[model samples]
Target: MDPKPSARVRSRTGRALLGAIALTALLAGCTATGTPSPSEVPHATTPSPTASDAPPASDELVAADADRPLEAIDAYALCRAQTYAFYPGDFALLEYAPFDEASVLLRGDGLWFVYIEVDDGNRPADLVESGASNCIVGGTIGEPKWELFGVVTRGEDVVDDYDAPLPSA
Candidate 1:
């Protein structure tokens, strides 16, 4: 049989446990058990490319209907696929309405942003986490003819406002 822990050792161990518990609570937001709750830890988002791909020697965005938001989403997808390795299959999101929240982080910047939720080729079996990730596409909204400002987030984690803007001319 081993000897019992000394009073000093017990105190140190208890202090360590308390410290760990405090850290867990701090990070986990509100949890009765001091564990990581689902909402506490926001899901991670797919990362975006650092630099944007330049337009194909043209400033005009070719589309059947420039007024249709779907067309712009398609353009965004097309542009994003070129830079991001994981893509092409995320087409279903083309129908979703754009979530405009681009300038929140970069206030005073005249550019407006549009966001779309992406389906990153995850099979039905792979969706264990069941979290949503949105992509950021920025441009001059309300312009008669809109040009693709850039692909910001390809369904990546957005901060105050998605910071990643893959600017293409």
Candidate 2:
């Protein structure tokens, strides 16, 4: 076979190159003013929290063994660990957006609330409860004095409900 491309193939390649050049020129002319049109600007398909719309900080300051009745920091750490274990590899929680940190709050009723932002559709409440339960070292009849409630969300939508039973670690 000849090393040179066939005439038919050469003609098709030349046409494709000319088509690309024409498209580039058309786009350049459309943006000749150097500023992109409103239609040309990319828009977000999902709602994200802007600087002013950011959620309030955690209800209480959480630190390991802080001067609090319950060790909230430990529970939060274990919850994150369990979350990582539940969703390993590509399905990990960190793989999703808006999951930079969790909002942890210890309510007056001795319930710990952990809110995590995740784009994934599934809720990992069992993992959270399992990790948090570890903090309940001793309680009446093996029942934990403090309970954990988890809320998983994506943008403004609540993907996971908080009806999960307490999981023993």
Candidate 3:
């Protein structure tokens, strides 16, 4: 004859086993869910650089100068004159009238610098004729050791307005 388990013990063991299985299934179900939806997800936005992000330079372009209304001129005529000044190589000049502003890249002493010129409405008549400076307000170059002697006029006249040595690049 074999000894049999009591009905109460067997029932208790069955309930315990079922409870354990249910708990395991519940935990697995929670883990099986996918990532949260867009509305529920946490995210971060990165800020972008703006014009006012950096302090303006000492010789920064004047707002009034930029806002000065420009007059249109013939691109072909301006190109011919700029080509002559920057001879033996192709030079790109903005195709706008009155030569209000310009950005130039010049090489000297085996280094490059970015030069910016703004019209101050005091442009010389000769420069106006050649379409170099309609009205030069301010000009600056980015070369610490390099000094901008002045722009060479059509007749080689050097206009010495700002002569400080550029900051070292």
Candidate 4:
């Protein structure tokens, strides 16, 4: 029998086969020209693009209804933005409590309190290990003269509290 192929040659052939299989899998839904096949092309449901397809203008976002007891989502966004202004670091909002009708009655129209809980994803490893991963932002809807921010050990139990706006960058 002819001498068997060298181990190096066999290994090369195996690697080539694996690469070809991976390439085939990656391009399976495409045509021979490497473009997506007709069936793979997504059909547009609308005849033309809509306004929402584009990013909302900053003015548009700022112009959202300012009434108290806003939709839960709107309140959440307001609180999240306020929180970001304070933190300015990578964090995710964990929860939010929007002022309610009773709150409006006690405070006033357009005067709503939002408590936003956030997870500080960019905290140092030491802080993370020490369970300092969460914080809270408490403020009114339209930039109150003052706001409360702090890291908490237990639910709503603010530990190191701060009452001033973060220095502008």
Candidate 5:
């Protein structure tokens, strides 16, 4: 015999070697996968508007003689007043009007005012009788032409008041 080894000793050694190799392979596989479980995964998200969002759209500059009535207060001017009077940030323009042959007055914040004259070639009448505060003013001037005087804001302050009218000409 040449220092013969027992079968029990050989079997134990083999099992230990196999166990170490299996553990190493398991660790390697985990690293290679590099994926999180469903519980660990994050959910989808929506983007929120930040302070640096694009500037609000400007009001349409139209001719005074066009089918649309003359807007005593423009969107830009309204936005400035809103900023001075209320919040400061991005905002949307809602509505503006002379609409038909109607006279409508908008007033708020000490320095801001809007007065529209919708005339049928005679005296102006107040005809902006219906519509939400935050929308476009839709109607014709003298003829039946449709126009859109969209809304505007300085941030969150609304400029939709008929309490105090601007000076009449």
Candidate 6:
């Protein structure tokens, strides 16, 4: 059974019209430049606050804690400023070799001692002492604090020789 010429023409026209409509809908979702249309953009998700975002409840540093290395270094630098009167730019020349030595020491008592050994050669040592007392007592007391035990110089030996304090004891 052969369809009429008019029926065949209508069937072809209907299929073409449906295909054109589908193509138009798809093309409408993208710009001529090929970027996604505004309607096709994904919704933005806002992130919630995490534990890292929260501030510390207490600002104090515990002596027995393992994470106090940076804090200990900071305390040493601060102690140099207050007790020794060493300024930032000039302090390096004083030849404080504390960092060259171990900056932190763990004692048998389970407490940490933050100490810096200073070898101040003659002229630099004189320049440092002129600013203030060469004695440096560390900042905080609860934990291991730096005590000025020895200040060595050329042709002269000076020593305080005090035992280090333990946080547990």
User: How do the residues 41-156 of candidate 4 rate in per-residue lDDT, one tens digit apiece?
Assistant: 76879878577786665444555633233444444454455446444465553323333411111123233334444444456654432222222222334443332333343333
lDDT of 4 at 23: 83
Q: TM-scores for all candidates?
A: 0.25, 0.29, 0.19, 0.29, 0.19, 0.31
- How well does model 1 score by local distance difference test? 0.43
Q: What is the C-alpha RMSD of each candidate to the true structure, in Å?
A: 24.6, 19.4, 28.4, 16.9, 27.8, 24.5
- Report the C-alpha lDDT of model 2 over 1-169, residue by residue, as the tens digit: 8999976678678879999999887677567687888887768898987978854333223332244443555545545544554443455434322223554555444555455544432436544222211112112222334454332323322213232335668
Per-residue lDDT of candidate 1, residues 42-140 (tens digit): 575966544465333121343323444433445344334433433334564323223342222322333323343434444354642332333333343
Model 5, residue pairs in steric clash: 93-151, 93-152, 94-135, 94-151, 94-152, 95-151, 102-125, 103-125, 103-126
Query: lDDT per prediction?
Result: 0.43, 0.45, 0.37, 0.44, 0.37, 0.46
Better of 1 and 4 by lDDT: 4
Candidate 4 whole-model C-alpha lDDT, 0 to 1: 0.44
Q: Candidate 4: deviation at residue 15, Å?
A: 52
Q: Quickly count the clashes in candidate 3.
A: 9
Candidates 1 and 3 compared by lDDT, better number: 1
Residue 131 CA displacement from its true place in model 2, Å? 18
Candidate maximizing TM-score: 6
lDDT of 3 by residue, 19-67 (tens): 9999886555442365545565545587766878956642344543444
Better of 4 and 5 by lDDT: 4
Instruction: Please say which candidate is ahead in TM-score: 1 or 5.
Output: 1
Considering summed lDDT, which 10 consecutive residues are worst modelled in model 5? Answer: 115-124
lDDT of 6 by residue, 1-169 (tens): 6566564477668879999999898778787689996778657697766889854433222334434433445555544544444344545556554544424433444333334454334445455433222233433444334444223332212123223442352
The positional error of residue 11 in candidate 4, measured at the CA in angstroms, is 59
Q: In model 6, which residue pairs have backbone atoms overlapping below 3 Å?
A: none
